[model samples]
Target chain A: MPAPTRVFLSGCSMMILLIGSLAACVQTAPPELLEAVESLDRDLVAIQGAEFAPTEYARFVQDWAALKGRMLAEEDVIRWPWEPNPLAAHLQKVQEEGEQAMAVATQRKEEDRRDAEARLTLLDRRLRIFNSRVDEMESRVVLGQRPIETELLVRQAHSFLDQGLFARSLQATEQASTLIVAQTALLTTELKRYADERLVGTWRQMARRTIAWSRTNQATAILVNKADRRLTIYRNGRPVVSYQVRLGYNGIMEKRYQGDGATPEGQYRVVKKRDRGQTQFYRALLLDYPNAEDRRRFHKARRAGAIPAGAFIGGQIEIHGEDGLPMSQTLGCLMLDNRQMDKLFEKVEVGAPVTIIGALKVSNPVALALADLEQFEEG
Target chain B: MKQPFICYLMVSALALAGGCAQPPTDKLTTAEKAINEARAAGAPTYLAEDFAKLEGMLTTAKREIAEQDAKFAMLRDYDKAEQLLAAVETDAARVNTDATKKKEEAKAVALQAQQAAQEAVKATQELVKKAPVGKDQKPLQAIKADAQGLIASLSEVQTALDAGDYRVAQIKAKAIQEKSLAVQAEIQRAMTKVGAAKAQKDKQVKKHSSR
Candidate 1:
């Protein structure tokens, strides 16, 4: 009975030992390892959801897969009770790396958002400047006669800004700016040409002749430069006094025909002098315009079809006093203030030589002066 | 007799361990559903950090359950996993609510910004209309075109709002406001300059005519 009992007991002991050993070797991952893997998985999902930098996300995925593979391989190794799981360390490393990757991705997303915001702000500012400059040009009436290319460029720039293409918007705005500056230059050139090409030479000859006539007669001679809106009184061949004058609405150009609002250019004599009550103006020194040279030019212009038929060479041109009205308001006359007209009338005779010319010089000042004169004339 | 005694002890231990240890299936499913609900509520866009934390917790809970499944039958214990999953469900619900509240707030702000931008565009357009047509016309027309572009960008703001990216929509609208304000300021300056120039010319004309 003792021998059989001992054999049964030995077999039961061995079976219990085997069962306990199998339980101990189950190789269940620790809670921490599972937690780390789950954390890593969450990070990967976030990375994907965020649409992080492709290179960084790809690297993170590869490293995560490698660590996961290593953890699964570690499961195949036999584990004994009281021994630490080998995969636990690897999983912890993967989790740590995943966390780092996720952090970087989050940071990158924040940075990208900030960068996009900054770009939008810059683009907006640039578009504002572009818009303002265009407005300025339009306000100045600089754009009415030109092509619409600048506006198109501005629109292109604005579209670029709207699309978040900051560089393209900037480029378009710059192009518009360039076009505007070019147009300004072209306008300035045209203004200078009007004064230089047609007015300067005639003025020099008229001024010299008037000075000579004054010196020879010891009398006052009047010389007017319509481009400068200046009237000079020469006494005994030297300048005596000068006064600012105004002319017709189209005063910058030479008067060519009747009803043209331009002050005429030529040598002439004062046909009559009248006091304030006798003339519409405060005082008047009427000139014999359409004198020999003017009549000749008018006849030639008519013959060449430069002037319309039935348009006569105008007469009754005068140096008049406006009292207080602007001299520019006259039809086609040289005008001065009443005080200046009174002073001249006191020193001049009815037949005194009077010369009216286009300009005094060929410089930009003459052009600018004429343009300013034209403004006053229009007003 | 001893072998039977040991077998009885093992069976009793197994029964005791199994008695209180049910799988956390219901809690896990509940937590998963909560997480899905939060995602559908736009938690990721409006509450990124909070949503990520919730996701990590859910993942940890699922991993704990998986760990329990990997264990030997006698050693399996899902009590901790079940508790964590229950906590995750609560956190997910809170996250969803908070995200919805924040999203609504952001939407209000975005709407205000969009209205402000539209107003700016209108103001700039008015300025363009009042702008004089002269040498400055080219630049003014260009500016008007830019203002038109800003108005067009409002559509993009709408797109962002529709997509539930309220923050982005607000930022874009703010940009438009700033630009339109600048355009208005520019128009004011131009008008002032034109006025000053006209005044000076009139003064000169009066002085010359009076003299």
Candidate 2:
């Protein structure tokens, strides 16, 4: 009886020991933890966790390593299945921490991206408006390298954005935008004279008179609108058509003297018609630019110290052809492409009236651009 | 007396341990100074990618130091942080060298553009001199004004170059060159018109005499 009892007890003790050893050797993990960690990994990369939430991400990384180390160490231990597996609970806690970090990272990234994108959009619009005004005044030479610098900054901002450095990109764009705003302010102020309603009314009235002259005499007339960048022909009070024309480099300003780069605002007559060989502008209708009114204004400006004492009353203003030049800016002249000039050259004879004005429409493209610039400045 | 002796030994041991646990502040300062010098040398503009990587190294080093700082003093370690800072310093020196070289190249380019712009302005001025007299005078004067504008922009380029803003100088000089070329084209067109008009005037004079 003693030998049999001893053998049974020994076999049962061995069985229990082997079962406990098997339980301890088995590496058990919460199944959902794998999927949860993987999901957090994806979001972490997507949100640039290392960049946006570096400290938290580093902590998560350290916890992950510790959990793996604990799991590996537990593989050699012998314990009953009833014992609580700390690895699973540790993994669950680390996963929760990691998930929390990823959530914060994603939110921060979205907020920074939104802020940077809005700034970029505003800077882009400001640049476009600045460029337009530059073209309008042909002020490229005046602005020097500012436009180029602003453009480069925008390109760099886009590069930083591509690298997910939103704050740095925003800083670069903000610097570029400051220059654009200053330049635009200067240009808008320079061109503000053209927006004066009283001056515009005078120009419009002068244009109306020229059209009335055409309708009364059943003859052709020419109207140059600086703000519209347009030259329209009226045959017997009806607008025959319009063509895109380039004015002076500083054409928005009323002409004062020679080399002023202003297209004079006045009524005139096409005193002579010079066909291609007769004129240097490909073909030309020479105009009386400094009529009595022009001389009177020039004298007044000189007396007021606005014009230099040595300045001459500029002459030879004409309606002319572009002759295939790429520039749209003219020297106080109404310019047309050679093909358009051919049509215009045959439409009117010498002495057909021509009137030049600042603006005929209140909401021309240039005026609208100035208004947009004001809104930008107000912001 | 024995307890006081034991306390002195512990104090010395703890002091040694604390010294070992301290962050490599001197290395961090050296690395930060190097980064600043690199930035001042225009590394951010010319060696942008390499500079960015260097900056990333600095951030990592700072984080590593911060990690150690958050640990118990007796357990803190700065060996990894010290390595990161050393790397940053080395890379920052390389970036500074590359950026200076790039800036010199840009300066040379800007000078070349300035020469081209100057030549174009001269050529355009010559054409303006030969432009037809009566009708082209006003327009030719305007062209001269444009040439003057080009000259003024060349001055701007010089100012930027003098300020060590080679990129800005290059941009200004290039713009001047482009505008000068356009003005030259315009003057050539005017010269052709002048020639044509002279030929026409000759033909007219001959016809009237023949009739």
Candidate 3:
């Protein structure tokens, strides 16, 4: 009985302990497997895989949980040393799927970021281009509040981009672009006459005829091209000098009657040259506006009900100085800066022939600017 | 005398036959309710990263519960899932509080942006008072229009802020402020031209006086 029996029992217990230790080693996750799973987790979290690649992310998480549950449930099971670890293989597959999800999420987030950036760029470009046209047309009064509304929308879109609201940012940008296109269309319609080759040709012909007349008479003549904002002087059928000029507040319209803020169009003469302090607008070369043709047209309009009952053929039109003021607000006149006026006041006598036309050629500033804006709509 | 998971399974089996080892229903409900509250507090918007982490935790908990339910009833365990659910509840609540605080901060930032834009527009208007009236005829009308446009844009910032879209309001106000500064720069350029012209005129006047 005894010492020999105890030693045999101890050896059996030691054998069981060695087998248990080997089984636990099989259950333990390999270092590479642990690293792969952990890395995949980090990538998913970093790229917001749950939000961007929801389906794939869910599958990966389920697979990972199932693997974890199996590893824990089989912790005490015994297996042979040479048998492959199925858990390691399964973990590999799960990590691969998770990596795919990460890739998808990364690509989607990048696409959204690019989309938001593109919309921002387009909106910014449109704002700049449209604002420039509005400045040139002085058409803010005409389009009232629309440009302001568009600006607000564009800004809101930019804010949405900042807050990672790509869809909202794109929507707002689209809306602002629509407004800009509509306003550009309105401007296109308003300035269509400037694009008309026939109308432009007629105006150019009128200027040419006046220049020809200057050559025939061999006397000093003045030509005012309103669209170009140029006033040129001709001596002996050749232009000797030119100056930049300003017109009426509503300078685009052809003059009609008394108090109409429109510069008249036609041939005329400098009836009086009022020198320093003689006129309110610094200096004046008062033109003989409302000539025979103007009076005939005025009466015709009055009879034809195009003119108001009390409307009269307007007068006192002049080529004048800007009075050294910062702004040159004109009413039914062509105004030059004081520096240019001094030169003009000395060159022209009281009876010099002066011709005023809207433009001498096609492709005026207004026409060119409208075409640039149209490209945005077309693109 | 048994493995931890096996011992847990044995205990679960000995519990009530039909209602044995339930799937953390109360904890799940609390976590779901907290997540909804966090969403209402703007967690998705103001605390996106943290909210995303909370959502991931909820998903893991739900998946763990599903894994446990798939096992035989006698071997069911909700321990890991319940711990995750408890974490989700705590995290969701923290996310809600943090989001609320972030939204308030955004609102303050938006207000500051609006005030800055208003000040920029005011400064531009003051510059407009000195805008050049040259023969080209641009600075006065264009600057006035820009000033008016900026003023009108600021109202939109207020509307967005009232609607609780702080980012939109902030961006609108900031853009308007930039536009106002740009307009002011243009006006300054025009004023410089005006000054140059005046100096030339003064030189002429002095020459005439000497004569």
Best by lDDT: 3
10 residues in a row with least lDDT, candidate 1 chain B: B133-142
Off by over 4 Å in 2: A1-106, A122-149, A183-187, A211-221, A229-246, A249-253, A292-313, A324-329, A337-352, A372-379, B1-211
Using Cα atoms with residue i matched to residue i, what is each candidate's TM-score against the true structure? 0.42, 0.51, 0.75
Show what share of the native A-B interface contacts model 3 retains.
Answer: 0.28
Q: How do the residues A1-379 of candidate 2 rate in per-residue lDDT, one tens digit apiece?
A: 6999999999999999988779666767776886787677666755667677766776665565445534544556665667786767888888987887787788888899998988898888777876776665544544545665566567657656666779877987888888787777776766666777887788889998999999999999999888878899999999999998777655666688987677888888999998978876778899988899889988999999998999999899888885422223366777777788889899979999888887876676666777777776777
Candidate 3 — which residues are off by over 4 angstroms? A1-5, A8-12, A15-39, A48-94, A112-176, A201-221, A233-241, A248-274, A286-317, A327-333, A346-355, A363-365, A372-379, B1-26, B56-84, B203-207
**What are the per-residue Cα lDDT tens digits for candidate 1 across B1-211?**
9999999999998798785476878888888999999998889877665666566666666666787788877677776566666767887999999989999999999999999989998988888887642222223434555676677777878998999878667766777787778778877877776677667868998999999
DockQ, all candidates in order: 0.04, 0.06, 0.29
TM-score-sorted candidate list, best first: 3, 2, 1
In candidate 2, the residue pairs with backbone N, CA or C atoms under 3 Å apart (3 or more residues apart, or in different chains) clash, namely none
> How close to the true structure is residue A43 of candidate 2, measured as C-alpha lDDT?
68
Tens digits of per-residue lDDT for model 3 on A155-264?
67877787666778889888998888888887777566667789788878878887887899888899988777789999888999998777775566567787665788
TM-score of chain B of each: 0.86, 0.82, 0.79
Order by lDDT, highest first: 3, 2, 1
